[model samples]
Target: MSDTATRPEGRRVDRTSAPQQGSWTTARIVKLVAILAAVVVLLVLPLYVEEFWLRTGFAVFAAIIGALGLNLLVGTTGQLSLAHAFFLAVGAVTYTYVSGTSGGTANAYGGLEWPPLVGMVLGVLVSGLAGIIFSPIAARLRGIYLGIASLGLVFIGQHVLNTWTSVTGGFNGRLVPAFSLFGFSFGGTDSPELVIAGVPFGQTERLWYLGLALCVVACWFANNLVRSRPGRALQTLRDSEVAASVMGVDVRSYKARAFLVSSMYAGMAGVLYALSIGSVAPDSFGLALSVQFLAMIVLGGLGSVTGAILGATFVSSAPLVLQQYAGSLPFIVDPGQPGIVASQAAAFLYGGAIVLVVMFEPGGLAGLARRLRPTTRAPGAAIAADGADSSQHSTPAPADPSTGGDNR
Candidate 1:
């Protein structure tokens, strides 16, 4: 019945009195349940939601991936970059060029007609390669200088996308080839004639699952990376590069690695973006797109993965949902109409939200959530928490006479 343990040194330590890491507490159980419920809802959402909502969900998933990637670089590593759109373009352009059919009249385009899977993989790799190539520049620069340097990539990419018509299809853009795994085509309507709970699985529905799977994988990897050694090193570097260097952290190497990983994530998101729109245009990967991603991480909370997801969902979906319900919503009008357009309205809303977050809660939504969470510790646990808090702030105790100041 006792939670105390006797050590070989005749010392009694309270085990349960102090909260154990990873132990299943009431809050942990509730959190686990909530996560499982959310997953179930997402999995079955396609069965109930219409095509438009499914399409929007897929777009949100892609945004989440992109936001997470940016957070790793800017939020965790403290490396400012405005070239996310360029990386996304690289992935989209690479995928389209590699898998597309070679034919056109006025605007000639070319392709190798490779498998979609291969194209997707190559897209991610090429994006990462591009990131690594630019990592040296990223490594040397910091703050807005790095951002400005990265911004040049977007312009260069735009010019290449326009001038290199054979690969990019020029300003007109090229149609993105549908993603497929083996014989199963994600874009096809009746490839296998699948049905789920009486809901016919169309292209939208199929792509929804693919996006969901990729989003989950991306989030999972990011979460793990943030808790790993390299992640800690990056965070350390972010806090103080001099300190990190003193701690034996390879500053430049880690910076390069972060760029590599983050760009690859942007690449994956790019492929999804292309698939979502069914096309890749130079205009789509512009300065505005990069700013939007920056907004996502800032609004979500820089170093928090969950914040990135929350931020991405709100930022990506607000405009679409507003446009979808423009007729019913007040002061929201269609394009070329009288009042504010849905896109402008959505931007205003999030811009105000960002300003408020910056003033009141610099940690963004994640910090707000943490502050709002209920503290439901048991009495012993409360004592332990108090002790931990006191220990953090209290001055060091005098050295013991017998131990010679070697407490350990």
Candidate 2:
């Protein structure tokens, strides 16, 4: 007998004809395998990579955090901000001052000598506070006006960094205190030695792992934030403030909150930047720095978490890599060599890339990735499957007696 059940209306239904649930398609299995393989490669890379590359990796990690933050504000929330460098400076300077010891010499500097963790936490808080304070102004402006208003913060921060001699070390800058956790250091050669697979884990290696962990956490948090309800609200706000307001989303409040959260992420990135460079200088956190971050989000694709990471990696690493290999490359030379310097060359390359991406692929790298991804089924396959199932399982309805004949 056919595997069917009779309904009250004299119709037969085939329970087995339903589509399969939770079945692992070939595309899904391939994606899972690819992700696992990439994770393994990232985990093992520090063991075999050189110290220079490890240092570059740490810088990339810091940039990734910063880019993610910028993407959330400008990309996801449709807020234009150029004060990111100011917030970064706030975090870096706070960490340096809170954790560093006073300079006993003529150019004296201040310090709290607190635990590094405390310094880090305070750095993030102070940066967030700065953002919160400026958020009111941000809520009042939009587009280039908001961006221009935010740009003022960078100048203000620069002035403070230069004149606040005791805290910021004046024009020359101050050393960043080494980070330690309960006496275990992630900086310097004096920390307890660690051996992994016959390779001595030095300061670079230790910092590499630390950076990796932090980057992972940053990515995870940003991904979750982008997928949450508030994320949807932010997207709505980006699309149309009136629509968002009608939907009961507090536009001003969310804008303020976005600034606060983005600033906090910049703070974390700033702390890592201080660690990577071993110093906090006023000249380092300038308008150019803010512009670089803007380039990152734009190149990576606005509103994409993965795109932020990719853009950060490219923008952060390009100049360094070009500088490293400049001697062998044509048309590129060292500073003052009367040729295209590595930094300038790198800028041209990415600037051109941005133009191309804008012209050809408006969605950026993330959208390109989606376009290239394999589909689980052929075109029209799902429709065909549904039709086949309906033909096999669904029964013709009973004739309408009231109409005195079949309606068909």
Q: On residues 1-408, what C-alpha lDDT tens digit does candidate 2 reach at each position?
A: 777777655655565554455656566688779877977888899888898999999999999999999999999999999999999999999999999887644226668999999999999999999999999999999999999999999999999999998899989899888899899999866789889899988898888888888988998899899999999999999999999999999999999999999999999999999999988889999999998999899888999998999889999999999999999999999988898999999999899989999999877888788888765663345655766677677677678889887757
TM-score, model 1 to reference: 0.91
lDDT of 1 by residue, 1-408 (tens): 887876544445687677667778888799879888988999999998899999999999999999999999999999999999999999999999888886664225668999999999999999999999999999999999999999999999999999988889988999887888988999855467888788989899999999999999999999999999999999999999999999999999999999999999999999999999888989999999999999999999999999999999999999999999999999999999888999999999999999999999999988889889987767667776776676677666666779988756
Give the lowest summed-lDDT range of ten residues in model 1: 101-110
Clashes of 1: 0
What's the lDDT for candidate 2? Answer: 0.90
Error of 1 at 404 (Å): 12
Highest-scoring model, TM-score: 1
> How much lDDT does candidate 1 score?
0.91
Q: Give the clashing pairs for model 1.
A: none
* Model 1 bad stretches (over 4 Å): 1-12, 103-107, 378-381, 385-408
